[model samples]
Target: MSQQENPSSLRLQILTCHLAASSRNMASEKEAALAAVPSDSRTIFDKIINKEIPAKVVFEDDKVLALRDIAPQAPTHILLIPKVRDGLTGISKAEKKHCEILGRLLYTAKLVAKQEGLDDGFRLVINDGPNGCQSVYHLHIHLIGGRQMNWPPG
Candidate 1:
């Protein structure tokens, strides 16, 4: 039968197509656009690394750099990042080769927490995408402390 004559079948087909597309879009919603881009592409982190923009640098090495976040969520808030992007746009884009840098970033967060006298405790956050509220594409660990952290962080 012709589609127009079969109104119910037409409605079903439209609903099915819409549902399929909706599912696919939802599946990809968690994906970051940066994942498709070259990881070496410069981000604002490069400016912080290059010292073109002044940041309260707290720690630095040949591999990693830690600086106090300008918009501090806690009394002691620092951002630990790799000196080299190395195709690490975010943790979601991390590959096996990124293990070393990822480890360094986390370890640096711990060491800096001690230095900041957050012996009580601290929070390390790696925001991945829009849902994580990751404004910058570069991979960095946020170390926040000097106060009690609430559970179920929004």
Candidate 2:
């Protein structure tokens, strides 16, 4: 589906397990309390991670969540996000200590893309700030595939 066709289209299914008591919504679940930028951060990622907003969960782990992008640029466009924000805004905000997370996120992207049946080819993108056309502030890995990509992707 296209963004223009259905603006609020999120293909998420319940992929998380609750370990604490909260309200009816999973958005109020256990991890919700630990969200550092909970209020200050309202990006699509926040919604995807918090279960406040829905998304097609492609792959998930204790520290990560991979889902299909609502606004797909390719036949397969998935966003890989950290379950814990850890103050990462983008690739630029990555510090020396972020090596583990940075690697994990990328590794997860490849795994997700392959799981999507993109054995032919795929691309991993990390859009930075304004110049990088990054609308969302949270760090995310864009896994695009199902076609022959080109160089100098702009």
What's the lDDT for all of these models? 0.75, 0.69
TM-score per candidate, chains pooled: 0.74, 0.71
Worst 10 residues of 2 by lDDT: 7-16
Best by lDDT: 1
Off by over 4 Å in 1: 1-40
Per-prediction count of colliding residue pairs?
A: 0, 1
Q: Write the per-residue lDDT of candidate 2 for residues 51-90, one digit (tens) a residue.
A: 9987789899988899887767688888898887777877
The 10 consecutive residues of candidate 1 with the worst lDDT sum are 29-38
lDDT of candidate 1 over 1-154, digit per residue (tens): 8854464654454344334433343333223332323235787789989988888899999999999887677898899999998778889999999999888888888888888999999999987644354557789898999999988564
Report how far residue 120 has shifted in candidate 2, in Å.
1.3
